[model samples]
Target: MPEVLDARALNRATLARQLLLDRADLPVLDAVTHLCGLQAQEPQEPFVGLWSRLRAFDPAALSDLLTGRRVVRTHLMRRTVHLVTSDDLLAWRTRHDAMLRQRVLGVYRTELDGVDLGELAAAGRAVMADGEPRSMPELARAVAGRWPEPGVRALGEMLVAALIPMVQLPPRGVWRVKAGVRNVPVSSWLGREPDPPAPDGDPVGETLVRRYLAAYGPAATADLRAWSGLAGLPAAVAAIRDELVSFRDERGRELLDLPGAPRPDPDTPAPVRFLPAFDNAILGYHDRGRIIDDEHRGLSVAGERVVLVDGRVSATWTVRDGVVATTPLRKFTRAEEAAVAGEERKLTAFLSGGDDQPTA
Candidate 1:
């Protein structure tokens, strides 16, 4: 019989892995890599995401990393724009190519009828090859002569999102900067082609499984697929199952995790954490009962910025008139309220760059 781990147990382990338990002292780049990447569709969200997980995180450092090319914002993992390290982008992009294409097509298939994806990809790549950052509309219009039926949105969705590996250049994701997405090919931006898929074995897939568990584990396979947006990891999971240990959640779903990964005691103290909208800690799992209640699950996908009190979703937060305002989902204990208030003050300072005023 597999050992049974309850929700609180999973919550503690998850918090430990997510660097929310004790803020990580790692460099931003290393932290980004370790967590695989931060979901960055909302350009400014990753800054708050980092602020919550890192010790004394400097938003300027993140901006510098983006400008310095140490990190890139690109479409990956569930087909969302993610702020990932350059190496992770090159190493993982190829593995995600098919999934990316399928994801784009899932929405645009009818419009894309009669279009040759190979030709479209070539066209998109050629337009991007001129070393200019092109917006999605600009890229799509450039190729519209070749495939007008798909419309700019559908064509651009496929081209920039899937067919060509593209990245959102700096200023779009640079801290405190509000900018539109302008894209260049991943190869052109990074000065290297993506690592080709392994012909003989599934090394990358195995690595993804290992990395996923190290970061988000004691998780079910469904949770893995939900996080990765890749459907083809069963073989990868099987290929490395023996190297993993298994446990069962209270719901009796089998959870797989790396042997030495931390599974903190259920009673471990959790600090109040204010997560940015669409945070990975909440959205990364198919079953989020460990960290959020089922009734409140919609909040995660609905883009509600949540406050975690005692390691559970306790309230929703927003910046109201430069104040860090919170609305409780359930009444908070006095201690929890104080913890939340104290953290919000620090967060306001962080978000405002010590201005004592909240931004966003």
Candidate 2:
């Protein structure tokens, strides 16, 4: 019989893997790679994500990585923008192409109807071939005359997000800097194209399964699909099944995990953690019952910043005039309140540039 793990055990394992049990002493680049990537639809949120997970994380270091081309903000997993290492982008983009196109079409099917996708892709490449950064609207206008039926928003979204692999360049995501998105082809920005898909077996798919397990393992295939928005990884999982260990969840669903991955004890104490909007730690699984309650599940996708007490979401937090205000989802014990207050103070200091007046 596969070892049966309960929800608390799963929560502890998730907290450990997500670096929420304790802050990891790792460099910014390695941390980004380890988490696979930080969901970056809200540009500044990733800095906070890193701040919570890493020790003494310097936002400037992440900014430098962006300006230095070691990292990029691009559309990936779940057709959302993510802050990913350039190497992961190169290695993973091709595998995500079909899903990207399908998602765009799902949103803009009528507008994109009667359009030859291949030709539209060619025109988009031609427009971007000049090596100049362009906004989505601008790129769309440059080719809209040829496909006048589809409106600019529809055409532009498909072209910029799905057809062409593009990076949102700095200072769009630079630390403490605000700028509108300006896109350049990933190939031009990275000085090389994304890796081509294989003719035979799914190597990229296999890599994704391994990487997902490494970070969010002891997970079901449904959990993996939910995290990635990829419907096609079961084959990948099947191909590598022998290499993984399986366990049964309290629900009787089989969970797959990397052999040596940490599955911490359920009684292990977890500290107060402040997570940014859409933190993968909460959003990365199909069944989030392990870390968040069903009643509160909407909070994660709704983009509310949350506070974790004892490895489960306990409160929602927001900042107002340098004060971090927290609203409890449930009544907290005295110790939990103190831990949350202490962590919020640190978060406020981090947000307010080390100012001592950060009240919780």
Candidate 3:
């Protein structure tokens, strides 16, 4: 019989793996890969995500990665812009290609009716083969002559998002820098081609499961599905289940965790940590009640950045004038406020590049 771990046990395990229990001494590249690529749709959010997890994390290190072509911002995993390692983007992109295409088409299938997808894919690739960075609209307009009636918005979205493996160019992800998205092929950016698709079943899927468990485990198959947006991973999980440890959640759902991974005591002291909007540590699971309250669970989907007090969300936070301002979702005691403010000060320094700032 699998031991049933309650919500608090799951939350502590999550915190330990996510590096919130204690700041990890991991390299930036490893950290990005570990978290399955920070939810980077908002561009600057990954920096905060890293800062909260790593001790003395420099925003410039991430910027250097972008400039060095070591990391890339691309559409993958649920059709969102994630700042993934170049190696991961290469190894994992091909596996996600079908899902990416289907998702984009799901939104624009009506708009793109009668379009020959094969010819469109060929033309889009031909256009991107030139090794130039082009905005989605620009790339779409360039191909609009052939697919004239598809509308530029639909065409551009399909090409840049689904058909092509393109990286959002630098300055878009540069530290404290603002720039519009311009895309170049992943091949052009990294000087290497993407990994070929698995000859049979997805080998990459198996790897994804292992990596996910190492970072966020004691998780169920549903949590794995929610995190990757991949259907039919149960086979992958089942294939590897013998290699993993099994437990049950409070709800009796079987959970799989890495054997050597941290599962701290439920009563372990967890300091206050401020999470960025769309932080996957909380959002990656199907049952988020382990780390967030049921009533406030909607906030994660809504992209509201939250403050974790005693390892559970007690407030929401936003930035104004480089100050991290907290609004208590539930009234906090003085000690909790002090802990939150102290952590907020650290967050402010990270955001402001080592400058001391007030945390209101």
Candidate 2 lDDT by residue in tens digits, 1-360: 999999999999998888888789889999999899999999999998988888888889999999999999999999999999999999999999999999999999999999999999999999999999999999999999999989999999999999999999999999889899999999999999999999999989999999998888799999999999999998999999999999999999999999999999899998888999999998899999999999999999999999998899999999999978899999999999898898888888888888442222
Whole-model Cα lDDT of every candidate shown, in order: 0.91, 0.93, 0.88
Task: Specify the poorest-scoring 10-residue window by lDDT in model 1.
Answer: 351-360
Candidate 1: where is the Cα deviation over 4 Å? 355-360
> For candidate 2, which ten residues in a row score worst on lDDT?
351-360
Q: What is the TM-score of each candidate against the true structure?
A: 0.98, 0.98, 0.96
Off by over 4 Å in 3: 355-360
- Candidate 1 lDDT over 40-135, as tens digits, reads 888999999888888878888899999988899999999998999999999999999999999998998899988989999888888887899999
Error of 2 at 338 (Å): 0.9
Clash count (model 3, backbone only): 0
Over 4 Å off in model 2, which ranges?
Answer: 355-360
lDDT by residue (tens digit), candidate 3, 195-257: 998788768889999999988898998998888878867777878878999999878898998
The best candidate in terms of lDDT: 2
Against the true structure, what is every candidate's RMSD? Answer: 2.2, 2.0, 2.1
* Superposition-based RMSD of candidate 1 using all C-alpha atoms, in angstroms: 2.2
Q: How large an RMSD does model 3 have?
A: 2.1
